[model samples]
Target: MEESQLERNRRNGFLALVLRPINWLKMLGEEVHWSFVIGVMIVYGISQGFAVGMSKVSTMYYMKDEQKVQPSELQVYLGLLQLPWVIKPLWGLLTDTLPVLGYRRRPYFIFAGFLSVTSMLALSIQRNLSLAFSLLSLIGVSAGIAIAVVAIDACVTQNSISHPSLAGDMQSLCGFSSSIGALAGYSLSGFLVHLVGPKAHVDSIPSAARLYCFFSSFYPLHNLSGVTLTSQGVFGLLSVPAGLVILVGMMLKESRVHKFTHRGVNEKFLDAGKAMWTALKFRDVWRPCLYMYLSLAVSLNIHEGMFYWYTDAKGGPSFSQHGLFASKNSNLSLITYHEISSWLNSDSELGCSDVLFWYGMQEVVGSIFSVGAVGSLSGVLIYQNWLKDHRFRDLLFWSQLLYGASGLLDLILVLRLNLKIGLPDYFFVVIDEAISMMIGRIKWQPLLVLSSKLCPAGIEGTFFALLMSIDHVGLLSSTWVGGLLLKFLKVTRTQFDNLWVAILIRSLMRIIPVFLLFLIPRSDPNLSILPEEMLKMKKGDNTLESENTEMVSLVDST
Candidate 1:
């Protein structure tokens, strides 16, 4: 009898495991509209895949190899592209407070999609586009994504509020979609780049040439006298994701807003602004906000410098697009920095012959990114199951400490120390990437949860946007400071003697936030961060009636 009972229990557990995914899908279908699910998949999953996996990688290579952009300059340009995100509050406020042509969320999605599609198409089709024009186009694309992100976040937040019981499931679905999308996109990125090439035929200019044309006029469209770099068809594929964003807008079901008045709009903005300001005055709110900002800013984002060093440095392993890990059947030999330099000096025939080899190397990096996506999902699970219950201060202190320690892997990779430990560069890099990505997601997850708990009832959207904007501001600061550090250290495109020093400095700076853990509340995740009065103020804010319930959740959902 005992043996039979144990067998039945074992069978039941196995069946439960097999049925979990189906249960998840059923719950999602029952909880939210089909259109909402589709919108989330496209916005969170597919968009992330294209942006990170394909567009980001291709653009970096295009700037580096074709345009000869210095590491510092690239950092600045990329930071500038994130301008729209830094002011996400504006997008959030507009979406929540104002309706366009009688519709709110749907029209914004349409606008975002249209803007992204236009920018990508222009970038792909233009043959001799100027450097400034290319940068602006990329910025436009980013703006579109940012707007769409704000809208989707609003949707998720509203759903979470309405279907409080299924909030966790909805959040999970969103994260899963993003993770799977990123994995698929990154897995295919290198192959796509290999097939299409990374270069674009932009008229390159001198680094010292000021892009005043961007502000003054569009007259200087291209420098015809400048060298025409290698062109690729990869840029054309970017339009597909943007087009899907449009489909998301069309598919999303939203009721028409019949109310309209300029005075009402002003009143809504005023109320949101007042509520946001009020929330900031609380020590619990402002202290953590300040800590989050300093933590991000001090970390310093010297990724561009590191990327150049990875691919171009003569003193290090040149993990170029074509040569790091050569397959057995490949005609080209495994290339080092010396070989890469010589190949560049060789004729077009030699370069053309090596394209396949270059793509094989790129695949290794793409695989690393794909692995990181899985690592990120693992992080979410680990946090949800274990760390979510811990006190905020303790959780952050240990995570921040570990975060700094993870930087040592990059240092080890750059120094080729793994080779001494019998680890191949490819194997070591993949592990390093996965571990770092997992730790990063873990560290970021708590802050997102904390941010959500801090949101007041009526002004959730506006105040959350304000908090996110603070975070973006920190990111902008980090990017600019990293650029300055690279320039100051003279870690240019080819010169990487001081690369390790920059890495060491960044790692040390990441540890500085550990000392600021006192700013975080000691309360449990279940406790509200805001004061009781702030929570109770939901009744009086009539101006924010239409806007308050649908606040943004950009980071929280991810």
Candidate 2:
């Protein structure tokens, strides 16, 4: 009977491993989770676009000095002003972890929505304000949207962790929603921007020598200039939909997400502090956290490298001149398939929001290719029972090493591939991007899973928020370092071939963390089961002794 029970338990464990969470939406009838995800995506996608349009683009076109604004002036002004976004994570950690009305995800979503919407409305009102005031106003709008973004991310992260089965569906919905936002905003921005003519024809000047005629064709040849850079930094237009989706999603009555009910009382708000301390106490946490930061830094640097590559090697001319903007509107750009005007407009205004929007677009292509990156994790989810037999550390180590190798391979593609044709280079870029995404999926998901499992039942939400904070810090740090690094590298549009070196350095950063991966404590299978079976054995031993004593008494009576 004992052997039979043991065999049955082993079989049950095997089934558990094979059926871990991935299709949570499908399991829940595709109604609740999927609908909510889609609805929020649309709302936020639209909101994100609006946010960019009102704050960044409008501010750019607000008219400077009455003698048509120069792109350089706006660029210089924005360069100094966009610093608020980098520190947003610090405040984000606060809002996400604190509960406003006896719930974690609900109240925060409402606040974020309110801030995001109100800020945009205010910006639209002050569209033609003075330069200093306009710059300040843009910062205000950025603050509101930035706060809202982290709050919404908090919801998705916590929700998915609670329902592991829904991880894949959640990520898919996110992809669809983010991509929609990017597509709509980018496509629209090109057409609506304030047009600056490329020609500068002065009525008083003689036609013999037009001073700016040699500068760019974006301006009329004899007229000297007709183009104008028509923007502030409306980049948020691309991501506004993401925020709108989350805002409306506050309508979702937090699903019955029942694994263990997280502690949600009014007094429980202080747990965020506890979660922070808990995470910090574990020296082991730093190993992977370092890896995450290093990887993001490398990715950002590569992005900078690519920007230089496009300007110098792939595309002709520098953005410092006005003619390029005219060229962009006249179908002289790479993304001509979609007629996105402001993105390439001669006088475009951009905000930091544009960086995030483009990043989201890149992630879409990357997510599709990350299946191999998380292959081991998928196997673990699919064959969870085998995990009882296998060591968790082994799984983690192998996954990180594989990811590291993929990063290196990406470098090779950039350097060695003698793609005489642009199509071949594009193909390699896609592959490299896919590999990078795959490794990220594999590496990052595990961090969430481990934290979710290890966190004490009562403080799960707060603990989860704390983990997210660490993740954000990693990203924020990368942004800071990337800015300085780009400035230092002087990585210009002219030096395209040197991008391979950037790729190689970025790939190499992953190596240091590979050694640290093994230090993390593996999940203990022994603790996850019921102790009632052992208790039953102890009870059975006393009953057998009592029966034996009864038998002895009967024999003595005989």
TM-score of each prediction: 0.82, 0.53
In model 1, the Cα lDDT at residue 464 comes to 65
Question: What total of clashing residue pairs does each candidate reach?
Answer: 4, 58
> What lDDT tens digits, residue by residue, belong to model 2 across residues 1-558?
999999999999888756643344345435334444544354334454333422332343343322233322333444444344455445544444343454444555556555555554454444345666656655655555555555444445445444544444444444334434444443334333322212133333334322211111112223322233334324333234434434453554542222222344222334445544645565545554555455444443344344333223433222222221123224322232122323333244542223211111111222222323233234333333343233345655666676667767555544544354444434465566555554554555445444443332233334444555555555655545554454455544344444565556655665566665555556442222112221121112111100000001111211
Model 2's TM-score against the true structure: 0.53
Candidate lDDT scores, in order, read 0.71, 0.41
RMSD of each: 8.9, 16.7
Residue 481 of model 1, lDDT score: 100
Query: Clash pairs of candidate 1?
Result: 321-358, 322-357, 322-358, 461-551
Worst 10 contiguous positions by lDDT, candidate 1: 212-221
Q: Which stretches of candidate 1 lie over 4 Å from their true place?
A: 1-15, 21-38, 159-173, 197-232, 321-359, 531-542, 547-558
Per-residue CA lDDT of candidate 1, range 313-368, in tens?
Answer: 77655666334423234563565434444444455243232333232354455676
